[model samples]
Target: MPRTALFVEIPGVLIAAWAPDLLLPNVGIALRRLRQRNVPVIAVTDHPPVEADEFPDFTERLQRAILEVGGELAGVYAALPDKPASWRKPRPGMLLAAARELEIDLPTSWLVGTDNADAHAAAQAGLAGVVLVEGVDPPTEELGIVVATARDLCDAPRVMIPRQGGCWHDHPQR
Candidate 1:
């Protein structure tokens, strides 16, 4: 079973989940909420591309996993190429490419992941911002930005706000 962490919604005020696996507990309500709001939803990841047949099986499995957990599947964006500069985390290239291909405005989009790389990518790609999930931390002193968890992001203030707060090392909690 997968674990879910809720994240902030974009322009449509929807809800999203971030998990290593697709199935999650208590995600049904959130998925239904997003559906009720008619928001565009998707899953973003750094997985490399697979062959056509394999990709379908993977997508089907993912969809089934979501449904099995009582969650809805708006869509998923995977199959990123293996080039670091083009598809790696912290680059924003793969995400930007996906946004363009999907016709989603980068500014109104949210990137949910479990690392500073994803956060940096969101910042670089003009996303509303990133919702950093639990269990990953990059040195805050080195990286100027630090996001806590998915739930923290959902309740974050509206509008694009810069991180002018204390550095990661400055906080005792970190």
Candidate 2:
């Protein structure tokens, strides 16, 4: 079985709404379940440099929240403000970086995004598959990319687990 690493986008996927820092419904419960199952989760996000500088401890706070809920945050990688366009979801820089840091095989990994472009990017980056949260329609034709849908964040792991087997770390190959 191939190892599965979860690459999530924070603001829309994990965070409750489009507003200021509201956690989406059922996020905590879902995260706990993923953790109990030994899944690795990494937040691949894009935040303005000014926000990072002004808040300073924002990333730490996000990581702490995940820890408090029993989920292991492999790491948080944000796109540089200066290079915003290149670091956005359709681009795979942050996802690639997380795979390297987590020692996850991109070809066997899975990425869950709040939208289509994010999922498409993961597939483009060589991930085995991508999961789009409900409400976003997947492409009519497969682009050599496997796609799935989670009714919401709570359903994401449930949707991903059966699709992606055990972590590659547990296998002898790595």
Candidate 3:
């Protein structure tokens, strides 16, 4: 089987809140299961610059939480520095950039995100599938599958068997 890669949007997917200390649920269980199955889980998010004077601790905390969860973050890509102002999600830049940095085959990978636009970006980037979390508006076009929970991604036949006791949360939009 071709190796599977996961491109997750952190702000609204894995974490529930960032301010007043991170309030991440046990989403790590799902990630840990993926890791056990040899699937590479990479976080591709658009966060403020690490050097931002206003929120110096934001990046650090986020990284720490991701690490605690066993996620292999592919480095947060900033649209301001790396690409033109026109580059943003719904555009394939972030996803493509992460794929390149991680040296993964984009066309054979799975992109799971809370936003429907991410599904569009995944399609544009030629990803194998886009797993959209339930409760989000369904994509008008065929992007990929709609999963009820983040753990459902692991249950997909193409991915891995669903493990019990994985954390499930309805992540709020940031």
Candidate 4:
């Protein structure tokens, strides 16, 4: 079977802002827990429009941010402003690229994000589902891919992932 992976969107899921300093409360603990289980976590992000290929220091900042929060990543992929449309959110390119690079099985993988674009992209990319960290009270109808919602990244597992395959990063412990 193709290995399942976890795609965590930056800004909202991990950090509350674009900078490396604002990691959401308890996200660091949650991310570290995932690593202890051997789940390969990947970071995927989209930056605001910029004149260059990417926002200066975005990759470096992202890495420092994750590491600072006690989390680790199997890989990192960012959709640059100057990159093709397919690489941006509301599209499947970045996720697809990460999946291909990591040999991930999209249909069994999961994405945790905070926007409608995140849900749309995960669905388009064929991921099994999405955990909307911030969304409507009853968000299921908004996107076919949104399988659950949590108050924040810290609450995801308890809210939806009660058992293996129940929600985001729903793979058996390796």
Candidate 3 residue lDDT tens string, 67-172: 6777545455544454654347788887777766767676556677777777777778877566665357657765543322344433433432222222222111
The prediction achieving the highest lDDT against the true structure is 4
**TM-score for each model:** 0.60, 0.80, 0.68, 0.80
Q: Return whichever of 1 and 4 wins on lDDT.
A: 4
User: Scored by CA lDDT, what does every candidate get?
Assistant: 0.48, 0.69, 0.57, 0.73
- Compared with the true structure, model 4 gives a TM-score of 0.80
Question: Candidate 3: deviation at residue 48, Å?
Answer: 5.3
User: Which residue segments of model 3 deviate by more than 4 Å?
Assistant: 1-3, 17-23, 47-57, 143-174
- The ten-residue window of minimal lDDT in model 2 covers 165-174
Segments of candidate 1 deviating more than 4 angstroms? 1-22, 48-53, 67-71, 79-85, 138-148, 151-174
TM-score of 1: 0.60
lDDT of 1 by residue, 1-174 (tens): 111112222212222233323334344555555445544456555642344456567667666765654455556655334345555666777666666555655554555566676778776776645555454554364333334454332332222243544321122210
Which runs in model 4 stand beyond 4 Å of their true positions?
48-56, 135-146, 159-174
Per-residue alpha-carbon lDDT of model 2 for 1-174, expressed as tens digits? 334667777776777544425556787887787787677778776642227565347667777777777666777777756555757767777787677667877776677777777876787788867778857888676756678887777776555543346533243333
